[model samples]
Target: MGCSNNWCELYGSHTSLCGCFVAIVLHGNKYITNHKGQTKPTVLLDCLAQWGIEKIFCIIVDNATANTCALRKFQSSFSLLSNEAFVMDGEFMHIRCAAHITNLIVNDGLAEVDENVSTIRNAVGYVRSSTPRLRSFELWIDSGKLTRGNFPLDVKTRWNSTYLMLSKALEFRLAFDKMEAEDMLYNDYFMEFEGGAQDGGRGHDCYNPEESDGVE
Candidate 1:
């Protein structure tokens, strides 16, 4: 852990315990492959020694198994102290950093309609299947009878951003419905869900601009 004149900090990087695949590199981040049972702490120890770090103050970890495994390995092997927040130390121990805890919560628990969600997601993929369809969607939007909501494509966007998908596709109800009538998803479950979703009588930010999105 490192320390500022007025504060102390600890730091370590951890990824998803579920292993969905990600490679993030912060200024001091070192890549490590972690698995269950054996060999990781030794490898991590070697890496730290190579980097000339003798002590770790905290290990920032999240829902991924590999990350959880790695953090435990580090804690057992070394004599580092435990703290839940960031500390300016050589290596600190902190589990479930703010962003990661939120991710874990979302991944583990969120009330949503799954089937309708998939229908909306696949629509974009379906559109990409044919350039003509894509072009038609574009044209539909240009005709002023449709509005496009944000379609987030980030990794975290997969399951968590269904609302965004609904808002986007649902906004252009006429265009989407017209397209639906002529194609594969004519009787889509999402169409029904969209039609009966939260009433828009009053302003609500369930789907809104400039709000922090949720993902698990």
Candidate 2:
């Protein structure tokens, strides 16, 4: 029986704690269940014990305080059982979630390139905010004879969305450059708002049309 605590907001109002349970094994069918309660160590242990899963070999969970405490208490109980059903010493039962670790690593690396990412994100937002700007961008694409593709806007909170936005924006770098040079409204908008309080004074100097071809 593997369990983990997940906190979620209901209807964007009330916050609730939920415990996710999963039966994992090398063979046979597996099932998952969810229980809502306090994420204390004793509560989690009681939930597992009620499921008749006493001979647990190991518990895989993220490196949370409650989970670590639960596992420490659970190890003592498992040691008391005389039957040799449990494998290993249960000392190294808790395994940190790999996906969480990878997210941490990727987010850390993203911090180094945040300024460049923000520049691209803001440029995309600028073009997408108005119908005339979007139309102007489409016209630039046609003028350049470039294959048309949708320009995806990204959610700031999600790193993968930012990556996709940058990837898609790179394909239309020429179009963006052309629009910046030829479209009067586009230039005026940037001059007025690019370094203003609305955009936190992030200037358009970072997105030079001349350097668009070499932007990474």
Candidate 3:
């Protein structure tokens, strides 16, 4: 019986606490156990022992040092019990979270285009930061016959948010260009930004202007 445990946060009316949960799947049946603790190896071991789980095939967890240590300690303890349930000497016990790995890879890739992203983010922020600017942007959208929508600010910690911001920005590209031409404030800000970039020896547009124009 291979079982896995992971820590989760729980919120209550009065307080929040961290706890561990254990789950086992075999023959289409799943068993679960929950315990309160900091997800240390000893707490995990105690939880499993309380559940009378002597045979553990493996545990799947994120790539955390505490989880690795816990798995090692659990494997050692199981070995001492001479339990045959331990597979591959617990070599394949620790499974890293695939989603976490993907997020890391995506974030790393996004960093390559961070300058362009920051530019768009700043532009969106400027538009949405004030009621007057948002109303002006809406008027620009109407005049340009562009799609009516709001500019979304991206969350710095979320890659998907950046994606949404870029997607929406592309959809409203004409309106943004119209604002640059007609709105002195918007025009001055971009001009100053470009000047700063040039002075810093990074004289590049936030994104390729031609490419932005070509997007249908």
Candidate 4:
């Protein structure tokens, strides 16, 4: 179970091949009014009833306070019914999402290098801002004797995208330096980021290959 922007997404997973392979299926989605613990359990129960699903081995949810409350309520309600509804009387019914846990840890570690990551993110955004700028950047890459590849922009919510963005950008580090030296637009592009209100007055230098090491 996961709620984002007042929408709750429920997924169902079952073990196949005698508990060897796990198959995940999307059960349903509902537009939630809020993230209240009470609301979530009720919504899940309603979905289960609609699906005619009575027995569930476990429920995996992200680490959230509301999920804790929802699990407690769900378990209590299930306990009222027959014990066959759970594999072990709901002893191991609540499972925390491992991917979410890892994402949380990675995001925490990346916080220390947030500014450095932001610089590269903004640099990529600059080049991708328009077709003309992209052409100029490609020219720089060609002149610098660097192989050109698609520069993937990172999605802030996913740390893996940031890693890809930085790794790919490193290939064209020399090209960025070349742009800073030769392209006036490229040089001025970063000036707006320096001491800007949006960035909380954190001054940024023009993207430098040397600074890429900080993020690495």
Clashes of 4: 0
Model 3 over residues 42-93: C-alpha lDDT tens digits?
5555655655655555555655566566667656765776656565555666
Q: Write the per-residue lDDT of candidate 4 for residues 40-145, one digit (tens) a residue.
A: 6676666566656666666777777878897799778866666677766667778777777887888898888778778778888878777778878888776442
What TM-score does model 3 achieve against the real structure?
0.59
Candidate ranking (TM-score, best to worst): 4, 3, 2, 1
* lDDT scores of the candidates, listed in order: 0.45, 0.55, 0.58, 0.64
Instruction: Compare the candidates by TM-score and give the number of the best one.
Output: 4
lDDT of 2 at 58: 48
* Segments of candidate 4 deviating more than 4 angstroms: 1-33, 142-149, 193-216
Show the lowest summed lDDT stretch of 10 residues, model 1.
1-10
Clashes of each: 30, 0, 1, 0
> Which prediction has the highest lDDT against the true structure?
4
Give all TM-scores, in the order shown. 0.54, 0.55, 0.59, 0.72
Instruction: Give the lDDT ranking, best first.
Output: 4, 3, 2, 1
lDDT of 1 by residue, 1-216 (tens): 111111223345522111121332212444434345344455555555664555555444445666667656666665443343223542435454556566556644443533334444556554555556566666656544222333332233333464455565555556665665665543342344455573222111132334324321
lDDT of 2 by residue, 1-216 (tens): 233443332434322223333332211222332222233444544554554444444455654565566656656665675454244554445666565566566667777767777776777787888766677677866544222246678776556666678767776677777776787765666456544544442224355556544334
